[model samples]
Target: MNDPKLTPQALWHCALGLLSRRDHSRLELSQKLRQRQFDVELIEQALDKLEQQQWLSDHRFAVVQVRQHIFKKHGPLRIRMELKRKGVNEAYIEQALAEEDPDWFELALVCYQSRFRNRDIPDIKEKAKRMRYLQSRGFNSDQIRYALEAEQD
Candidate 1:
């Protein structure tokens, strides 16, 4: 079997196709290109071109990712970890999170309510389980407390 030849144009096209589908951090895009067996130099050149044209940006990617994860009911902690995994810089991640300005307590409450709409007030064991669930969803202790206390309000 013959391996396909990778060209600069081909790399650019592939990057563009991925970007068209969703915002990708620079590192994510590079990893995808590398996985497809593209040359390092070609991938760099194509990414640079995309950056120059403003078609690719880690800041934009981080912002979009934060919003998407928030919509999915993930807390800022989880979102920040995800962004870090995607290779976004700390500054961009902080900027994006700050700009979004999500009310963590309110968001946690909504997420908790939606997840346990039909369940009765949790007993001690059940409360522990629910607390673990919310924590895994990236909420802090205070946010989780606020969410679990909704019944008392």
Candidate 2:
């Protein structure tokens, strides 16, 4: 599918078509164009125009990704890492998370309850396991502590 004759207009339309499906970080769009064997210079030119037109923004992408991850019950750490992997700016990621202002402890509790639903953690080993589970899901130690204690109380 490599077409050496592909032009800038063609690349622009292709990029826009991809974005119409969903928001994409600049890096993600670039990689997709690269996969299609589009000329790197043409891809960059299209991206610059899109960004200039405010049609492709890392900020918007970060916000959308954050909301989606939150809906899936993921914690901030995981979401942040994923956005960073997608090449979103750290400032934008932080801004998006701040704007959401989610209750991390509550989310952690919900996540834990979904898995263990009122089941008492009978021993240190089991409690540690639950804490570790929440941590793996991206909740911080503080939030995990609150979830464990809040449920047992």
Candidate 3:
């Protein structure tokens, strides 16, 4: 249970402990603090202090998340959705994505080839299945089509 006498310093220390483990967007930190039964005003004050001290930033979190997702070979669509879910704003998401200039089409091709290199594409059904797999991996329709066509060439 939350003590009615919980001080702002206590709440800030709790927030710092969470931040020490991993980066968190402001909203995510607020939600976690709230779950611990901290008062809303106290949580806001703690978050403001963290932001002021430059120890918390949604922009930094988005950048790190985007890089990690790209390394995992997840596509832009999936990455964007994940960032949105993490309470990152559109500006930060776009800025983070813009900083990385990978060729998505080629990336999609590489991802497809890596997964389907040994398989035989024998029929329309099989090709369609492969296309669906690529789509599920977050490649856009153009990127999927290009990757499939590249396989035929």
lDDT: which candidate is best?
A: 2
Error of 2 at 23 (Å): 0.1
Candidate 1 residue lDDT tens string, 1-153? 134557776778899999999989999999999999999988888899899999999999999999999999999889999999999999999999999989999999889988887556657888898889999999999999999887557
Each prediction's number of clashing residue pairs: 0, 0, 0
How high is each candidate's TM-score? Answer: 0.93, 0.92, 0.90
Worst 10 residues of 2 by lDDT: 1-10
**Stronger candidate by TM-score (2 vs 3):** 2
Off by over 4 Å in 3: 1-6
In the order shown, the candidates' Cα RMSDs to the true structure are 2.0, 1.8, 1.9
- Tens digit per residue, CA lDDT, model 2, 1-153: 256457777788899999999999999999999887789988998999999999999999999999998888889999999999999999999999999989988998899889897568899999999988998888999999988888889
Q: Which candidate model has the greater TM-score, 1 or 3?
A: 1
> Judged by lDDT against the true structure, how good is candidate 2?
0.91
- Which candidate do you rate higher for lDDT, 2 or 3? 2
Compared to the true structure, candidate 1 yields what TM-score? Answer: 0.93
lDDT, candidate 1, residue 55? 99
How many steric clashes does model 2 contain? 0
